[model samples]
Target: MRDNQITKEFFDWIRQGNSGCIFAKLFVLRGGDTPWEASVIRAETFDAPTVEAIGETLKLASKRSEAIQLILPNIKTPEQIARMISCLCKNPNWYCTEIIPKPSEYTSSFLAGLRWKLPDAVNVNWVLGFADIETMPPTRRAPYTSLAIRLGQPGTAPSVAKDKPNEVRSRKKENGLVPVHLADMPTPFLKDDAIKKTWVLTEQTAGKMLNPTPEFRTNAHAKVTFALPMDLRDSLIGCFTPVAMDSKSEIGAEEY
Candidate 1:
């Protein structure tokens, strides 16, 4: 499907008021390193009947993943990370989140504290591998002209003169620390020319893709079994087992 079509379908699916699990998978197509790699990182079973519930689920999943850290590594403070993630939750379009340094961190304790937060029937183990992505392409090296313009200007407060070499090195790091512009931020999943896309699928649609038949438990297990080094396939398969229904009889019994 076209990228725009997929995006619309995703939003529409999320708006449906069905009581079932929802799963989101992120896919990235790198230039030369790897053609494509994906991870099913977010899943929620909602009893509430509202589109907002779906948004809340995704926001919570994003928070649990610590997604801001993936895009901004220098933001070491926890409060800052929380605030940034909060902002993204409100306006995911105002800024973007990327998985930097690699995707392994998403699986490593990404769901550690989530057990108590989720409904008992909703299995957390269903999520595979960490959702973290490797580092954003390094900021393009700054130009010499820009460096000269920045260094030549004196600080707002009075300061003693330092050696040119030391002064230049310090200013270089300072200039590089400027926050990256939203437009300049690297696209994590698509080529430079390809259109970026996202999709949200209901559990049934996702299941069809991941586990089409009774024989296969999950699509991830079938397609990327080797990629999952944690070896949690058996546990994941167990989680997919259908919940049984109660067999209570409705007819009243007569007493002699």
Candidate 2:
């Protein structure tokens, strides 16, 4: 099938409400070389019924031997993956999501090949997955996975946070002062001066940091400083920087 045709089918599937993860295959043929590339796209905002229709629609598309893949819902187990492969092989554009390196091999290949170049706040790697396969072509031998951080308005797709994996879940649940470099830090909305000479920030909590972004400081019209001895200020500033602010994030907002 053509690229435009696959896109049309994708949007149509969306209209029908089949949301979950989708596998996309793209094939380009020139001269004797036929390059096949496959990717995974999790439905950021489709419901179950809609996702079902998308699965069926994709099955039909694969039959045409086009460069597109559609991963239907309810195919979570290895057996299910086998069934999916059987169904997809009928399409001339067959490519495997699984490759040797390990659980993340295919996903790593996709990111390296595509180099998607996303924004700073959104992490896309967390959303990719791969299937188990027996053999793969040399060019296609590497495993492939695809994930994205949505940049559109929040309401468009329920928010990616709700679908984060357990690793992320653990990170969110982590409270207490986790030692972090001063340079690498999350937005610090919470901070306090335990002593005239010491400043403390909590990674486990939300809002209120001692030294917030320069913009926040200017906006709040508050004179802010490290509150450390003058001689130590420059050295502390270069350390992994944490933030301090006087506002609060909404309660339980981290869940989503």
lDDT winner: 2
Instruction: Give lDDT tens digits, candidate 1, residues 95-200.
Output: 1122111332223211110011112222111111111121100111111000000111122111111212232223211111211111111234433223221112
Q: How much is the lDDT of residue 229 in candidate 1?
A: 21
The TM-scores, one per candidate, come to 0.16, 0.20
- Worst 10-residue lDDT window for candidate 1 reads 142-151
The clash count for each model shown is 12, 29
Error (Å) of candidate 2 at residue 71 is 11
